[model samples]
Target: MPEHEDKRPLAERIAADIRKKIMSGDWVPGLKVPTNEDLRGLYGTSNVTIQRALQILKDERFLDGQAGVGVFVRGQGSQTIMPAHYIAPAGPGQPYRWLSEATKRQQRSKYRMLKVAEVVPPVEVARALGLEAKSTAMLRSRIGFLDDQPAELVHSYYPVELAQGNRLADRRLIPGGTPALLEELGYPTRSQDDVVSARPATTEEYEALEIPRDVPVLEIFRIVYSDNDKPIEVTMLTKPSHRFKMGYHLEAS
Candidate 1:
């Protein structure tokens, strides 16, 4: 006989059950979630643990709770309206295969240029780029929509001398994409570093993505280096946790 393994933490297991229902479409968007007291009894847990379970789904954007109306499911079809970290194809002779959305998925996405200007870099960005504190860089900010859903907000920075008076300063998609454009101009991206984190959305980001203020975001800062090892581009991208997810595949070392 099985050892009757029930060692998983109560709150996590409770949250897992709710998460499954939402993901499996049994409780789809607008469907009400079980009440706190109901969940408490089902899992034989206290009010606090039950509340914690619900909070997990809320954080994941799988459930929305109205003060008086209780909690309801939120649809999960993010891929229908999201973009991948790498959004370009690998050219002939390229060593690595580019990971991007399918052609149909690409057609469903759109982007808007929000701003393009020269600004003194933030301290962290300045450090990343090895620039003086007062040095200015060309900043290009934009928002992307996938299937009419706001999917991401990105801000890219480059040395002003390299970006000014170029298409990178213009408010539109450049031909062959930015990486290709940069390569044609001799700053080919040879490698990049990415740092990922999550936190509550700021007011501006919350509004841009139309997500609740309490919703956390997956923020990634990518610093692209040229063949000469110069930091040529730094981009910060924010994706709503509820509206986006990421996956990675790696070969065994």
Candidate 2:
């Protein structure tokens, strides 16, 4: 049964109503959202009920509360969640586009390339890439930003043999992203395998992602496959939990 049909907590039900309004543009970015008193009157409920509902949205990053001032709608950061569904096939000629769940909007993201050189792969990365221990691979490390806030950190590893004579070694954005470059190199990607896990943020992650110690980060690690089941590239991505949410579409049998 749908959540609305169930006798869920009153706060959750109220949260759903406010969430719908926020999503539908009745409340827009940078707008001052309704206060607890206003919501209480609107819902014909007590202040406590309204506060609880607003707390749910605040946790989801839909709203931000000021100490003395009223709550306000967050801009791009809070308003958008990356889409795990409606994504292009994890294949060639189809870039892994991340779209905003808020009206499917596209945020202008900037890629800040870090290390782009051959490096010894970490034990886990090497294992995932099918490389023997002590093997060297071309590593491209970068961080993505939305509205000048660090959003996702990615590291792409390619076998030295596969990266030779290619722009993969360059510190720049490939014209159409990594998949397109792989396709041009005669290794068209045919599939993708993803592994997701969460762990406490490291010191570097805390500073780099501007997240606190108490917050955990989500890791989306994936291996790209070429035709004939050849694993060509492995990418590790990390995103702060409070700033992003992952959505999944499942098909029931």
Candidate 3:
């Protein structure tokens, strides 16, 4: 069939054509996709149409482009989860149970520990955790995946006192996620205030996550407090903005 005979929307048709090639492994990860000129010639379309199609794929996290290095296929199938209701702790012995229920309802979810260390808390982090500056803290950074796809990078700070002598820090404690670990240490049932913003990725972040410069990221600040309203942890979550949607429900006071 003549490619020009395909009368579909230019961008959609282009994206569909490329997506098929990707799925068939014709273009592997790190392999450059057809250039704008290449695509234009193949589809008999303008550079603008090709650009739009490429942009769509980039937003979908299926392609990564370098300033002068060209665009490359980023593999296929990365899932993203939208933020939902902020689950509140019900009571003692109930928080973990409730969390399990909440997570089950999540449309998608995944996580990977990136870095874990014991270090002195920074001034801002200490203040958030209600501790003195220079106080020891357990810093854990993770890259969360959703449906087997990279989603967000999260850095969590916890007072060292909370993790002292706890086996939860051990990598072998796989099933016991961070929240569950806290619960085991008797700091369950917490509440969080989430603040969100959008910005471009820093050089370090871009390299670490292999994100393109044109992509903006969503930064989420989560301050968690115990049931008694004592701040126990602070988390910073950074995610590709285009891949996610943040949703919340507000009730009448």
| Winning candidate number (TM-score) | 1
What lDDT tens digits, residue by residue, belong to model 1 across residues 1-253?
5679877678778887877666556777888888888887888889999988888778767788899989888755343222234634245443212113434345366677899888997888888888987999888898877667788888999887778667888877664557776776788877777788898888879999887536678898889888778998898889887666665544799
TM-score of each: 0.70, 0.68, 0.62
Model 2, C-alpha of 239: deviation from truth (Å): 0.4
Please give, for residues 105-127, the per-residue lDDT of candidate 2 as tens digits.
54566678877999998888898
Question: Would you give me the overall lDDT of model 2?
Answer: 0.75
Count: clashes, candidate 1:
0
Extract clashing residue pairs from model 3.
110-145
Q: Give one digit per residue, the lDDT tens place, for model 3 in 27-70.
A: 67778887788889999989999998898788667789899989
User: For model 3, how many clashes?
Assistant: 1
Q: Name the runs in model 2 displaced over 4 angstroms.
A: 1-69, 73-104
How should the candidates be ordered by TM-score, best one leading? Answer: 1, 2, 3
Q: What is the lDDT of residue 213 in candidate 3?
A: 41
Estimate every model's Cα lDDT from 0 to 1: 0.74, 0.75, 0.69
TM-score of candidate 3 on Cα atoms, chains taken together: 0.62
Ten-residue region with minimum lDDT total, candidate 2:
94-103
